[model samples]
Target: MKFPQYFSLLIVSSLLFACSNESDSDTEKSGIPAVITPVPLDTYFPPITRTDEWETVSIETLGWNENQVDNLYTYLEDNDTDAFIILKDGRIVIEKYFGDFTKDDNHAWNSAGKNLTSMLTGIAQQEEFLSITDATSQYLGEGWSSLTIDQELSITIKNQLTMTTGLDYNVEDAFCTDPECLIYLNDIGTTWYYHNAPYTLLDDVIANATNTDFNSYFSEKIKEPIGMQGLFIKVGYNNVFFSTARSMARFGLLNLNQGTWDDTPILLDTAYFNSMTNSSQDLNLSYGYLYWLNGKSSYRVPGSEVEFTGSLIPNAPADLYAGLGKNDQKLYMVPSLDLVIVRMGSASSEIQLGPSGFDNELWGLINEIIQ
Candidate 1:
């Protein structure tokens, strides 16, 4: 299916004109043009407080078209979105609670919670708790999978993070964490498949490596320091997290700063952070270590073998990346724009997993408003 191209021409024109018309004075004052000067990162590090409120940026100050912004919210509400928020320079630029949802309503992160697990796993490695290079069986024990000891040993922690574990997704219960459900499909790193069983197993890896409960480890290491409130509750075989929309935004802001919360370094392993947000393997350029990356030449979605051409979300900025969840729960970060966005609620459509057509449509609306 092709994405809508209604705003394609206008978007291209706006970007090109902005790039080609930098004045000499602008260049002299700063190496970059004034219009494109990055918002200082230090200016908006949210105070690490236990309160439910966050600082916000006025829409007028953002110079956003008010009519378009209203229309954006209307469109979101029409599509079953329970909550939507847009953050500019770490301040809430647009915050809306739809239906019966309020700012304090807790919502499930679904698969988007994987992004948090990925970050915490990096911290675990940094603290000498575990190593990505280590085999998955090393921590989970040798019989965690149905594969032979040798075949399972070949699957490393890195494979799990990159979705290159070569685990079979054709089983009766793909989400099942039982050893019998984790059948080997190919040699490690030979293919990339968005299998949930392997990804969910990362929790066990972290738990075993750190000798602490997953949620407690997360609280002490990440949530407490950043003033984020949430818990990874077990749902069947999956450990999904639930939090308020603002807490989701906080995590996005943390990622926007590359794992740092304000001046404090929540994840001091810079190398892991870089690898975690970029393409993690040669198989899928659009996938990092559990996060979804945009601006890649091609991408592969869950349950599909066909490769789609172009960036994952064409209407979003080229530098955009996201932690997308089932039912359209989204946490997007655009470093170039100094922006972070969150959306939570029921499924916008029948699509499951990450990078759905609704993403393109929603971003198209966002482009109309922000431009």
Candidate 2:
């Protein structure tokens, strides 16, 4: 029921050309109208090889309603989507680009790149480079935060991973990593706050733990293995990751496969993988290690203490865990469905941040097909 809107248009164009080329003899031999079927979707074969080739499957093969595709694209186009992709079993099911944005163009992951930090953290742990339970100061050194040394000692690497670092969220700049900016909000592990400073310091954590440069280590450990092309670029106090849409899909597929690529294990620590995608704390039922979890009975969002009652994306599958970033950058992984979805571009609306109405509305369209 779900496919990119462009697919049907391309097929219709192909059909029109076919009809024009048809001859009486050809028609007589067929005794019926020529049917145009795209061989590239499913028939192309294999998952992405990181080459120019990426296999695709036919919407007809999945029996999804093609009628909804146009509507989906209409909504996307209106919302300023630059690039969107849906991968099934690691094969691309839907890939659409808008305006001048193409497969080769780079886009920022925004906060969705936090998922990359989460993955690298796990890899750091797996390789015995760091432990999530270790105190943050143990790696970053003391006085990293304005908190008293005793109070600072209480903050752990797991706290950063879970957004429970107890760092103040009311500061003028939540993204500020300066020690003076990272004020103490509450006792460590007491509350779940969505602050970016502690999360961003994780860059230092990985770099220090691995005794190597952050991006270099990332490229060597995760990117190269999965054939991802992205690097963290320093922008003010934030180190934002930018890459092509296909690269985002590749990372989603890696998580969909539970940290494996082509049967090769990238994250050997099974426990970290399990914990990374599940609730890391009781305070936030809909959050894992920087990943937004769906299907929880209740959820919370950044800048709000009020817990909203419902799944993170009610229209999405219950098992979906996503990396939602600023301006609606998205990377969704549904293990149950063996699906990975990626969306990248400018904000569709004025309200910019993760988990907007855009998510629920878009999923409504997705459900029309996938359901």
Q: TM-score of every model?
A: 0.88, 0.87
Q: How well is each residue in 184-280 modelled by candidate 2, as lDDT tens digits?
A: 8798898987888899999999999999999999998888888888789999899999999999998898888788887778888888888999988
**Best-matching candidate per TM-score:** 1
- State which candidate has the highest lDDT: 1
Native-referenced Cα lDDT, model 2 = 0.87
lDDT of 2 at 348: 76
lDDT (Cα, 0-100) at 263 in candidate 2: 70
TM-score for candidate 2, residues paired by index: 0.87
lDDT of 1 by residue, 43-128 (tens): 47666786756777676666677778877888898889999999888887789999899988899999999899999999999999
Go through the candidates in order and give the clash count of each.
0, 8
Q: Which stretches of candidate 2 lie over 4 Å from their true place?
A: 1-49
Clashing residue pairs found in predicted model 1? none
Which pairs clash (backbone N, Cα, C closer than 3 Å) in model 2? 1-64, 1-65, 1-369, 2-369, 41-56, 41-57, 42-56, 42-57
Output candidate 2 Cα RMSD.
Answer: 10.0
Model 1, poorest ten-residue lDDT window? 33-42
